[model samples]
Target: MTPSIMSLFMNSAFLAMEAQQVVWLRMMRVAAGGASADRELSRMATEKMQAAIQLGTAATLAAVGGNSSERIAANAIRGYRSRVRANRRRLTK
Candidate 1:
């Protein structure tokens, strides 16, 4: 499959996993109870949410097949190699 399509699939999977984790955390917080417990749970949930967002962004980038610089560099290298090969062939003839 194309890189773009593959990226979309990976991003979707990552998001699904994140959703499950959020649900699990919410359930745990509800089970804990009490004002103090609620405060702690809120803190923990906020931290987890931040981390999940960071990770999700990374996953999205990976799914998107990363930055264009790498692809551009590779294409440049391929073109240069092809040119060199053609020059060598001409010199030989």
Candidate 2:
């Protein structure tokens, strides 16, 4: 594989790990009774909606611009990565 592809794969792998960490952190918080069921469900729903919007927008732009599939995937991944990073920071504190 090319260096760029390798880099993308590596970054994606790291992102996946971060995403898992965020999930585990949230689970821990809930298990510890730190968050109410209603609030947690609402927050999760809102986050999923935002992610869907972002992915849709990215895909639309890529299609209109005749960009490659990899670019679309990269853009989608970027949106998730940012959300995951923010969640990690918030959960840690």
Candidate 3:
């Protein structure tokens, strides 16, 4: 594979790991009584739904516009990565 392809894979892998960390941290906060469990769970679920919608919309637009496969994948990944990064920042606080 080309270096750019490898880099994309690596970046996606790293993002996945960070997202998992965010999930665990959020859960820990609720378990430790730092946040109300019901509210936190509801918020998390809502965020996931929003992210899914954003990702689907981006990917669909790219695909319909006749962009390359890579572009479509990038659009989806970009939206997801942005959300994951934001969650990571917020949860780390």
Candidate 4:
């Protein structure tokens, strides 16, 4: 069950990466028109990459069982919940 859950998370992460990449590529097309646009796109891409890395790391930690699997899974769940809440807040705003 844990492995299956981890796989689902991993797949979702990959989808997020693909979506981010598509957005970044589209941004790059517009970025070519101005220096400021280029800079902003670069910053956005960097932020997205950092978020992907953080999510991937958390998933990896949760997958590798040890004395801390329970703790890691709990932390991952908390992170997921926080993200959901943040998205809801953004949508409401």
Best by TM-score: 3
lDDT by residue (1-93, candidate 1, tens digit) is: 233545555554555565555556555655777774577467656755765576556555655776464443333334434433443343235
lDDT of 4 by residue, 3-93 (tens): 3566657655755665555565556555566865676567657755776788669778667745256556556655654554443343234
Q: On TM-score, who's better, 1 or 3?
A: 3
Q: Which regions in candidate 2 have their CA more than 4 angstroms from the true location?
A: 1-3, 34-37
Off by over 4 Å in 1: 1-3, 36-93
What are the models' TM-scores? 0.34, 0.83, 0.84, 0.37
Q: What is the lDDT of residue 56 in candidate 4?
A: 67
Candidate 3 clashing pairs, residues 3+ apart or interchain: none
The candidate, 3 or 4, that scores higher on TM-score is 3
Model 3, C-alpha of 41: deviation from truth (Å):
0.5
Steric clash pairs (candidate 2): none
- Give the lDDT of residue 85 in candidate 4: 47
TM-score of 4: 0.37
lDDT of 2 at 64: 93
Off by over 4 Å in 3: 1-3
Q: Show the colliding residue pairs in model 4.
A: none
**What digit string (tens of lDDT, one per residue) describes model 2 on residues 1-93?**
123666678779989999899889888877777446457667878998988987898799877999777777677777889988998998788
